[model samples]
Target: MSRPFRSVLYIPASKERALEKARELAADAIIFDLEDAVAPDEKVAARATLSRFLAEVDYGPRLRIVRINGFDTEWGRGDALHFGALAGVDAILVPKVDGPADLDAVAALTGKPLWAMLETAKGMLNAGAIAGHGRLEGMVMGTNDLAKELGSRFRADRMPLQPALGLCLLAAKAEGRVIVDGVYNAFKDEAGLRAECEQGRDMGFDGKTLVHPLQLPVANEIFAPSPDEVTLARRQIAAYAEARAAGQGVAVLDGKIVENLHVAGAEAVLAKAEAIAALAE
Candidate 1:
């Protein structure tokens, strides 16, 4: 089954305390951040600290991703080389990726799968190419930086960001790549976070990136399949199977018709639900 990415938490690589605490967090994935989270003076030291922690730690079933500095910065190349060589990292997140060329540059240095951060206007325009890149395993919406570039005002509903978000979503879906929503900055506002997480979930995001561990429960709960959804999915699958057995083209589920396409979607939901359950175990 495809792994669930309901809550992808970002932990600054420089903080050993945070790293230790992360192993116990309920995040489906952990992003050991070596980019914006690290200070200029701490860049080199942060790498060593993260390296040591990774070597000594066991993060269980949680997917471990390393967000390296961009090659535009002096530390970016070194971060890539270091983490790319490490076996603990599942994928290397390349920040501010404008197109496939950015992924190609890093692909040369690392054999690991890449995740692109679509933060710039250029990146949004070339989302298709980036998402379809051979080495790219996922796409991350870098909404904060994208807003800065667009000079767009903040809306609780993210109105200004919808077009960009939709474009990236379509790109990821078309290429069958996993795309996660951007961080919800207000970690203290659980109500706001739930609203945004629901929005992302409705928009077909695989998950939501998190800035703080406190946000995990909300994202996790919001993204996972609901009990009602699971129940409906099982019923749809059973009805379809029974209809197929009797040589019918379609089956009625509730008041609506259940076709092969509906069964496919229902199976996907159950697959995701099972994956989440496996992760919990």
Candidate 2:
């Protein structure tokens, strides 16, 4: 069963306070981040801090994901090597993944689900091959790094980033892997965040990766099935079933043709709704 990825909050592993606060947060997943969030001076200590905390704490309901540094980095190998019998880790998020070989290297080091961050120019170009890797369970957009690599300024619409975003989305969908939209840097702009989350959903992303707990409510609300959507899903399923029983090949709902493909989509919406409801319990 795939758990909800909506509102995945990233907390710096070096920050003891943030880690403790995460236990009570409403995020569907908590990413204990050792990369990007931690400075060069605190890399080793952060890893140790994270390991020690994970060993003792029980962060129930929140999916425990650890975003380790790249394998090519000095801290990466040691981070992967010292799994240290820690419990409650659900996945290992590897940053700057260029291709399948990067996943292979990290997959060999840990038995956890591998999530690749497609950030670089090369990674975007190789998204198809990377998503096809057997160890890969998801793809995370690293738009900050990608924009820096591309030398493009961030726009409200993300017009320049759309092509790369589309490629990653298509790649992940092709392989049936979870793919999440990158964080919005403007943490204070609630309206802007809402707009971006809506865009991501329309593009078929599973969720939006978040940087702050304040972003959680919007992400969860936007990604989950709306009440109207759930109602429409139920209606579509019922209409389709009735049509099939009456020896009809198709059903019409809201004046549009509903086919087997549409029914499958409706079922998926209901499944996600049920899964979210179960998680709340």
Which candidate has the top score in TM-score?
Answer: 1
Candidate 2 local distance difference test against the native: 0.90
How well is each residue in 1-281 modelled by candidate 2, as lDDT tens digits?
36888888999999999988889898988889999999999999998899878887878888888899887789998777665135668888988999999999888887888899999999999999999999888889999999999999878899999999999999999999999999998899999999999999999999999999899999999999999999999999999999999999999988999999999999999999998998889
Q: Give the C-alpha lDDT of model 1.
A: 0.95
TM-scores, all models, native as reference: 0.99, 0.98
Candidate 2 clashes between residue pairs 3 or more apart in a chain or in different chains: none
Q: What is candidate 1's CA lDDT for residue 215? A: 97
Tens digits of lDDT, candidate 1, 1-281: 39999999999999999999999999998899999999999999999999999999999999899999999999999989999999889999999999899999999999999999999999999999998899999888999999999999999999999999999999999999999999999999999999999999999999999999889999999999999999999999999999999999999988899999999999999999999999878
Error of 1 at 50 (Å): 0.4
Error of 2 at 251 (Å): 1.0
Worst 10 residues of 2 by lDDT: 79-88
| Per-candidate local distance difference test | 0.95, 0.90
